[model samples]
Target: MSSDVAGIYARESPYLDRYVQVGIAQGRVISLSFPETPDEGAESEHDMLDRIESYLDGVEESFDDVQVALTVPTDQRQVLEAVREIPYGQDSSVAQIARVTPGLDDENDDDLRAIREALTENPAPILIPDHRIRDGPGSTPPAVVDKLRSIEGL
Candidate 1:
């Protein structure tokens, strides 16, 4: 809780070594990471750790569905919005996501590749829930993507 601290607060699984690292600033979560290895700022004190711990209303559930503010390119916002509509435990391909997207400069069926590009550039993967994307559209690291899918039982 000290402004001087520049670190992440972790919330670990009670029976497993796995954990989630939450990063917050100005009342918004800037990042959420579930990794086998800690990321750059993987240290914290009790106050911040307490906040992270409170997010777990369900011990086995993944809170990746939560939305947060992200600084994405103006054009990519539509793509992200489309992606956010994907139901949990389900998925949509890049082409499918693009087909539903509005305000795209070009909504051609051939824009699958471009849609894929926009998804990979996501700054906040879990909050954006990019892992719900299928067939390699929007993406996160393969390992973490697997973790997301497994956690959601997709």
Candidate 2:
């Protein structure tokens, strides 16, 4: 993808009680965060923001159509893709993800650690739905994960 950032958008989120910021590059979300304060002059017209609002409103919105730009190793990308397949309102364990991840031995300690590392390094939280992973929030803050889980009723 291009190194140029197309735009950065932010909007107040009711669920998190903070502003949700999204970074877009080449029509795909490159990053997501909950900043204490919204960036000055940041636009708030992206469709992703609209969908996020709908999701926070208790709607079972699907983020599958929302494209994301993840810059990580092949293994981590595979794990993140597997996590995306998890249905909304449901959760999965690390072992389950490792089992589904190709070339990863679920019973092996190193493989499991790799899975955990991938999760902990997840750059996009809500967009990738890391909170859907049971007992694993990756790098997402505990409060954000808890709020997201509450929103999904999990």
Candidate 3:
């Protein structure tokens, strides 16, 4: 995984005890990681990083235009696409996402668990915005989700 990655940059956000690390590849975001403690370094000068920090600061910014590269299986990718469709300042249940997901079998052996699994493994938390998904933890840390919800006034 490290070999395939081109570069990673870190930036601090007062919103949490962690700094956001944005992974880049071919000029697009490929991964996003939030660590408990930020490393000593310059904040990223990347446009996407700037946009996210601005949005967290209550700026009128929408990440909907930012592109992400999901290096996952087809079914998980489909689930992620549905997760991305969740509008800003809104929420949806996992069942709702599964209903819109074509590759998902919402009835077979209780497909909700599969859907939950996919969202839990999402690499791009804010970019994919898994926190928008309702009814449970939905991938990211619970505290982070709560913070995001508060940030969006949801």
Candidate 4:
């Protein structure tokens, strides 16, 4: 896909690798190569960027308008508080929920309540890959199905 805007999301973990996607206001959409597992020794930002660049080597998408975004998987969200690079945000989108309520399923009701309260900050530019939005709401909003099954859940 050829578009002025491209976005990426990368993570380093056995459970979470990386994801890339490109989008335009109203044009072609591109989902760049997503490595199931990041290359060995890819423990730095530069290394991850190189890995991402290499992944996009053959893609025809426009990097000129590329807007890179990052997603710290639900498993890694809470730990991000110790890291200064990560930003926080609020909205009802799947990504936001995942970040704030990371592993919500495993979290106790009190933990979820705390997260709900912390979201008052409402961070902006909720960085997320374009493909995530395109991947549709199922995987992104995994709870939607269950929520829909019961109106009270919503």
Best by TM-score: 2
| 1-154: candidate 4 lDDT, tens digit per residue | 2233233333432222243222223232222233555444323333334433543342222232333322334433342221212222111433444354445542365544444333322121112221222112322223322322232122
Q: Which ten residues in a row are the worst by lDDT in model 2?
A: 1-10
Candidate 1 vs candidate 3: which has greater TM-score?
3
Per-residue error for 26 in candidate 1, Å, reads: 1.4
Off by over 4 Å in 1: 1-7, 11-19, 34-67, 105-110, 137-139
Q: Candidate 2 residues 35-153, lDDT tens each?
A: 87988888877778887889888899768987889999999999999998889999999999998999998899998999899998887888788898886648778888888889889
As a TM-score, model 1 comes out at: 0.66
Cα lDDT of candidate 1 equals: 0.62
Ranking by TM-score: 2, 3, 1, 4
| Model 2: colliding residue pairs | none
Candidate lDDT (C-alpha), each: 0.62, 0.85, 0.77, 0.30
Report the number of backbone clashes for model 3. Answer: 0
TM-score of 3: 0.86
Clashes in predicted model 4: 0
Count of clashes, each model: 0, 0, 0, 0
Q: Is candidate 1 or candidate 3 better by lDDT?
A: 3
Q: Which residue pairs in candidate 4 collide?
A: none
